[model samples]
Target chain A: MLKIDNLHATAGDKEILKGISLTVNAGEVHAIMGPNGSGKSTLAQIIAGHPGYVVTAGSVTYEGKDLLAMPAEERAQAGVFLAFQYPVEIPGVTNAYFFRSAYNEVRKANGKEELDPIEFLDLMEKKLKLVEMDEAMLHRSVNAGFSGGEKKRNEILQMAVLEPKLAILDETDSGLDIDALRVVAGGVNALRRPDNATIVVTHYQRLLNYIVPDFVHVLAHGRIVKSGGKELALELEARGYDWVMEAA
Target chain B: MATATNATGEAYEQAFGALRAQGGPSWLPALRREAMDRFSALGFPTTRNEDWHFTSVTPIAERVFKVAPTRSGPATLSPADVAALVISDPDWHRLVFVNGRFEASLSAFAGLPADVRVTTLADALKESPEFVAEHLGKLASGEGQTFTAFNTAFAQDGVVIHVPGGEIVEAPVHIVHIADAQAAGAGIHPRLLVVAEALSRLTIIESFASTGSFGAPYLTNAVAEIEVGNGARVDHYKIQRESTDAFHVGTTQVRQGRDSMYHSFSYAAGAAISRTNVYTQLAGENGETRLNGLYLIDGTQHADHQTFVEHLAPGCASRELYKGILDGSSHGVFNGKVYVDPVAQKTDGKQTNHALLLSEHARVDTKPQLEIFADDVKCTHGATVGRLDEDALFYMKSRGLGAENARALLTYAFAAEVLETIEVDALREGLEALAFARFTQSFGEQR
Candidate 1:
């Protein structure tokens, strides 16, 4: 469902993604692990169409369409979702209102009827339970003063509501406690389907225990240095990223 | 003494001549005489004056606006037309003024409480001369304020609301100042006097509107003098919705007594050139003052809001938040000052002015002044001018909202910070609708 070939991207004068290639099919969950500043998050941001990075020398194809050619909003409407590691805090805008606007926008783009307040509330209630979020969070400003774990849960709640075809979780496991990690991972595990895909990008191997990945890839110096089945994650966790870095 | 040139000077002289011809109350002539002398001395405040540095009244001065005919027979507008201009609150006691004169037919004074003395200023002067004489022009002085001086000198008819001591007015007093098109190229001075006695409570909604479409530009120079007595509470809201070609210069002066509360909100949504000055002084201990404003200007419109809050007594608090959203070639200016006097120990004051520019030609100039003379007082003021947050825009876009819709929503949210502070339900909803319409229209005009 997704393919990246020799993707070389730069942010300003510094190159972040150099000669990176990856592929993923439907129903697959892939984990991309790397040390800090190893381009793990950069790859995920580029896929989600963040404007800060320029794709210099490669193409990204999603279902035979040029994904990079679309704008960020268009990519979202096309069922590409990015759960930002640091969700922007927008004061004076309620979480429920923001979610409703976003949900209706995607619906309108797909030629679906928009849901009214009542219908949207019902959907939100259902999704809130998936991530174990309190109903009070809906009335507060969007991510304003929310705890780190609550912010992560809110992102997963959005994912559940939008039901995107391809989801990228960038550093979703970072800064989460054990219980919050389980809640977030459990929601993702429940939403997985054979027709949908997910890419988990993290700096730790602990999240793989909750939402086990079909494959694991070690990213070093903006390139995938090692690729293997799920066991590779345990191997790296026992050792360290240094072994993979030296080998690459 | 300094004097204006050409048409501007002639307009003042014409107003003085008319005031002489029309006999007023016993004290009115002397007050008008003093004001005329002050106007002649001050002329018009130029940019050279620090207070008027960002806003110029040259456009208003250049055009000559004759005095609107007082008691212009009967208003030709129907009740439905009047209803459209008001907030349509059934319980609100309304005093409707047309072309600066009392429209007794449209006013609903009988609905007010028995203890409340709500009547037109003209009627109050003739009937209750003592009450009118004691409080009128006491809180709002025309000494240094150019527009207040002009308004006081030529004032005709406005609302005079006096709630006796210990009386609580449940329903808000609505004062509607409608400038009819018949008074084209005319100047209408509408004055309001609100006196809430000790332990009393009252709410006032003052609306300045134009009756016809843009054509000949008129001027509405208004002044509202509010006095909140000891332990009293007062909420005052002023809505300026004049014609696109019209000009408005308004002054709202409030003084709070011991343990009193004063809340004032001004929304400037119309007029080619609109300047609103809000000044408040905490005269007693434990008084609370809140001054909030929102100005949305588009096209070639210009809106200026100058606010001054003085902390005279100890244990007083004041908060001010003014937000402006400018689109097209519009310009906005906000100058807010919070003064903590030497005797105002333990005074807590905060002031913030934020402006959002939607287009390249749109501009805003904001200055927040904090003068702290008390050693133990806490005062802070900040001013920020910028376009919309790009990161916020992208975040919204990635959530599937269109770029235009996202930008419009952000702009609306920025204005809501001030709009939401309004305690009146009907007024808040009405302003929200007006703001929404303005944003939609302007955002659609953008590329």
Candidate 2:
């Protein structure tokens, strides 16, 4: 579903991702484990087309299209979703209203009919249960004054509603409590299918326990240093990234 | 204190003399001449003047031309257009003025309640002789105010609304001041008098807008006097959304009695140059007043707001909140002043003005002043002018919205806080619709 060859990206003259290459097909989950500032989040943001990062070299193809050439918003319309590590707060814009607009924006770009408020609200009702979110959160301004857990869950709720093909969970479990982590993991697990792929980007192995990945890749010094089965995460948790760095 | 007369100043003097020569009433023209002497004596306001610190009336001082006598053409009005200015209030009185002239045909004054007096200032000279004479030029004579004198000199014709003792205006009294664009050089001078007698309650909504796509240089000079008697309640709103090319200068002069409550809202969204000066005096003990204002300016338009609330008696309270949104190099200025006399003990007053600049070139200057001679008073003031929150913008853009759409949404929300301050439903909706249309047009698809 996605291909990256020799990905080298920098933000404001500082190199963050260097010649990193990866490929993921449908029905597969990839977990990228890295130490702090080891290009894990940078790779995720580049794949999702963050404007701040300049991909100085390399090529990226998502769903058979040249992803690097498309704008960030177009990539979003083309089914690329990035669950932020730090969700933004938009005052006076309700979550439901923003979600509905975003949903229709993507739908409209694909030559589909947009759902009205009633239809969208009905769709949200079904998805709200998937994320264990109530009706109260959707009515308030977008992410304004939301609890850390609530903001993360709200991001998950948006993912469930948008149904992106390749979802990038960029440290989605950082600020969530155990209950929220379970609910979020359950929500991600429920959305998995053979037709879509999920990329879990994190520094900890606890999330991998809940949403088990098919392949675990260790990223360090702006490159994916190692790739192995789920056992790789347990080994890294037991021995630490220094061991993996030496082994790679 | 300062003396300099340019071409505009000489024109003002000639115009002032011309108005006195065409005298219609006995006392009004005398008051006009007195206002002219006051204007000449004060000269045009300069930066040295404390109230004119943020706003420079130099542009207005340079323009000496006058608006045409009266519109000789047909004013456009559609069914949809009527919806923009009409209110369905049948219990109280209604008055409509087009180009500063009374429009009896467009007004609705049905089921007139007894003891309440309502009439045009022209007719009020004879109908309510005592009321007009007693309160013609009572307020609006500060140390240095040139525009106030200009407006008082041209107080040609307007409406006078008075609620008798212990009476209540069951329905809100609506007033619409329509400025015609096709007649550019033609000027409009109007005065509004609202009096709520002791123990009475009244609500007045005064609006200023344009009729059609008018290019004529229009000058709207207006002064509204509001008198709140002991234990009375007065609610007032000043809405200005006229032609983008028109110039508007208005003053709301008010006096509060003992234990009275006066509330006011000002929405200035129209004209190339729009300035509103509000002066409130708490003359009686334990009286309270509130001033809420909102302004949205873009595309070279300028909106200036100045306010003064004076506490002459003890135990009075006042609070003010004025906000502005400037885009496309537009300029907005806000100046608020609160004065407490030596004897006004236990007085409480607070003022805040917050502004947002959508474009880098857009400008906003704010100044808040509090002068208290009394030792036992509480007074505070704050002013802020800034751009949209960058973090908030990033948050919206992350939701898949473009920069333009994100900006439009945030700017609309910023102005909505002040829009929510409007108490009238129809008025608030109209103002919001206008603000929304302008916001989207500049930053959204229309751009």
Candidate 3:
């Protein structure tokens, strides 16, 4: 479903993603694990078309189309989603309003009829149960004064509402407690379909236990150095990343 | 330049003389004479004045505007035309003024209580002379204000509202001031006097608008004085949406008695140059006052708001919030000051001003001043000027909103922070629709 060939990118004057290549097929869950400052989040943001990063030399093909040539919003309309590490606080925009606008935009782009507020609210109630979030949160400002776990859960709620084909979970498990992690992982697992895919980026192996991945890749110094089965995550968690770095 | 200024001053003097020649009322001639003298002495404020540093009234000073005729004449506006220019609601007690003259045919106050009195200032002078004499030109004096003096000297007609003690007014009083094409190249001064007696409650909406795309240059100098008696509550809303080629200067003075409450909201969205000043005095213990304002302008427009609150008694509180949205080289200014006297202890005051610039050339100036002579008081003030948050914009765009849609949404949200506080439903909805349409249209033009 996605292909990245020798992705060389930089933010400002410093190179972040050196030389990296990865491929993922349909219905497969991939986990990219690394230590701090290993470009795990950068790789996820680049795939979502964050404008801060400069892709000097690389090619990212999504469903046989060059993805790097599209703007961030266009990429979003084309079924790309990024669950932010730190969700933004829009002071006066309600979560329900934001979700409705986003859902209608994606629908319009895909040549589908837009849903009215009543229709959208009916669909939103079902998604709210998946994340175990209170309906009151939808009326409040988006992410303003929300708890860390609530923000992470809100991200998942958006992902469920949009139903993007390619979802990149960038450090989604950073600030969540154990209970929140279970609920979030459960929500993601429920949305897994035969034609869609997910790339979970994380620094620890705890999140993988709930939403088990089919393939595990260790990213060190902006390069994928090790690839193995689900057992590889347990091996790296037990031994640490230094061995993999030395081998690379 | 001196000759031009003299010419403008002489023109006003001639108009004042013309008004006096046809005036009634035994006690009005002296008041008008004194005010005219004060206006001549004060003249138009220059940029050198500290209060007028950020704003220049050169455009208003250079022009010589005649007094608009009292009658509508050939530019006769119908009831439907008047309804379309204001927040039309059948339940509201309304008074319509055209070119500073009361249009009784267009006004309605059918079922008001016997004790409550709502009429024109000109009629009140004849009906209840002593009551009109007690409050008129008292709180909003022409001592140090040039525009207030100008209004006092030239105001031919306006609205006068009086609520007796302990009477709760059910419907709001809506005062509509319209300037038609006949008012082109002329000046009109409209006055408002509201008196809420002890334990009474009232709401007043004063709106200024132009008639049907009237684009000629005119001047609207308006003044309002509100008296909140002991334990009384009053909510005053002033909305200014003049023609884009016109100029507006308005002043609102408020006095609160023991345990009284006063709330003032100013909304400015039109006019080439506009200035609004709100001043309040807490005269008795445990009084509360709130001053809130919002201004949205674009296309070389200039808008300014100046507010002052004085704490004279112990246990008084005041709060202020002003927000502005400027685009297309527009300029906005906010100057707010709070004073706590030596006798006023345990006073609580807070002030905040924020401005959002939508274009690269848009500008804003905010100044917050606090003068405290009391030992036990809590006061704080803050000001912020910034563009839209880039991260928030990106976050919205990532959720599938296009760049233009994201910017417009964020800009409207910034304005919604203040619009949400309006207690009146019809007025709030009207302003919200206007703001939404404005931002969307401007952003669409940019694209």
Candidate 4:
């Protein structure tokens, strides 16, 4: 469902994603593991179409459609979702109102009818139960005064509502506790289907324990140095990315 | 700094001249003449005036505003028109006006509480000349103020609300003022007099808005006198969302009796330049007072709030909080002061003003002052000027909200605190819609 070939990106004069490439098909979860400054997160951001980081070379296509040509919002409507490491807080805007607007935008993009208040509420009720999140969260401002874990849960809550085709979890496991991780992972696993995909970007191998990935790639120095099956994450955790960096 | 002065100055002189014919009790014309003499004596305020510091109204002073809609003041509001500003509570009564003039033909005053009474200023003047003579320009008025003198001289028709003694109104009351800008250079000077008798209760909302694309640079200068009698309670809200090019200057002077409670909540979002002044005097011991304001400005809009609270009697309490969010090149100012007399002991007062600058070009100037002569009193005052928390902004973005959307939401939330302070549901809802639209436009959609 997603393909990136020799991604070359930079922040100003400094290069971040030098020449990294990866591909993920439907129903498959791919984990990109790397150390600090290894450009793993940059690859995820560039793919999400964050402006600031100039994509100088390479190409990314989703379902054979040009990805880099679209704006961040359009990319989102195109089923490209990114679970940011930190969530933004919007005061006076309730979770219900925000999610409804987002859902309608995407549905409208796909030539689908917008859901009325009642219909939207019903959809959110089901997703709320799926993520084990309460309606109380929907009544409050968007992520205002929410905890780290709750924010990550909100990210998953939005993911569940939008039901994206290719989801990019950018350090999604950074702030979650043990129980939260299980809930988040369960929700993510529940959404996995043959027509959708997941790309887990993390510096640790712990998140892989709940929702195992089909392929684990060690990203060091802005390039993929090693690629293997799920066992590769455990190997990287035990030995560290120093070996991967040296090999690169 | 090249002001629109010559225009406003000429306009003020013209409006002030045409109003001299509105003779009341002979004392009133004498007062107007004196005020006019004082205004000209004062001339246009320079930076030297302490109150005018940081705010150079020279531009406002120069531009001339054509005499307001008085020529076509009384307007008809259809039921559809009322719905645009209606609050859904069937329990209360409402009196809607068009451009500061009373429109009894279109207003509904059925089944009003017995103790609650209302009359147009013109009607009240004819029915009870005693009350008009006794209270006219009684609380506060001055020729030193060009606009106040102007409003007094014109002394156009307004509303007089009196909640009789021992009557506590269960429902709210609204006075909606809509301006017709179809007439070029027309202006509106709406006035209000609210008197809550002993042990009475009242809630009033005074809103100023405009319709049509007359597109002329009109102006509105308004003043309200509120009196809360002994043991009475009053919640007053002033919502000003005039046209973007309109200039609004208003004053609210309140007098509280022993053990009375008075609250003033104001939200300013429109107008090219707007200034609202609130003055309250704790006349009797144990009186309570609160003054709050939320002014959100973007682009070239400028909003300024100046307030003063006095503790004349002992055992009184007062609180004031004003917040603003400025985007683009908009500017904001807040100057608040609390005064405690020597005999006014046991006064508990707190004042706080904060501004959140949303852009580098957006500027805010805030100052809080306290002058206490009493020995036993608790007084606190503070002012803060800054921007939205960056950490807070990034946190919103992390939740799939774009950077612009995050900023917009946070700014709206920042101003929501002031909106919540509005006790009137209809007024609050109206303000909420306006503030939401404002921030949304500035920050755009973030879905």
Per-model lDDT: 0.88, 0.82, 0.90, 0.80
CAPRI grade, predicted model 3: medium
Write candidate 3's Cα lDDT for B215-317 as tens digits: 4689999999999999999999999998897899999999999999999999999899999999999999999999998999988999999999999999999
Predicted candidate 1 versus true structure: per-residue lDDT over A80-169, tens digit per residue:
888889888887678998899999999999999999999999998889999998899999988889999999999999899999899999
Q: Candidate 1, which segments miss by more than 4 Å at Cα?
A: B70-74
Could you list the iRMS of every candidate? 1.1, 2.3, 0.9, 4.1
Model 2 docking category: acceptable
DockQ by candidate, in order? 0.72, 0.30, 0.71, 0.17
Predicted candidate 2 versus true structure: per-residue lDDT over A1-248, tens digit per residue? 89999989999989998898899999899999999989888888777666778989999999889999986777788888889888887765678878998888788888999999999999999999999899988888788899999999998999998898889999999988899999999999999989999999999999999999999999999989999999999999998999878876
Pitting candidate 1 against candidate 3, the one with the higher TM-score is: 1
Instruction: State which candidate, 2 or 4, has the greater DockQ.
Output: 2
**Candidate 3: residue B230 Cα off by (Å):** 2.7
What is the Cα root-mean-square deviation between model 3 and the actual structure? Answer: 2.0
Q: Against the true structure, whose TM-score is highest? A: 1
Q: Give the per-residue lDDT digits (tens) of candidate 4, residues B333-430.
A: 89998999999999999998989997899999887878999999999988889888766654444334556765677787888867878876766786
TM-score of chain A of 2: 0.98
Judged by lDDT against the true structure, how good is candidate 1?
A: 0.88
**Per-residue lDDT for B324 in model 2?**
91
**Model 1, range B259-345, lDDT digits (tens) per residue?**
999999999988999999999999999999999999988889999999989999999999999898888899999999888999999
Q: Fraction of the real A/B interface contacts present in each candidate? A: 0.58, 0.27, 0.60, 0.22
Over the true interface, candidate 4 deviates by an RMSD, in Å, of 4.1
Q: What stretches of model 3 exceed 4 Å from their correct place?
A: B1-4, B72-75, B212-216
What shift in Å separates residue A205 of candidate 3 from its native position after superposition? Answer: 2.3
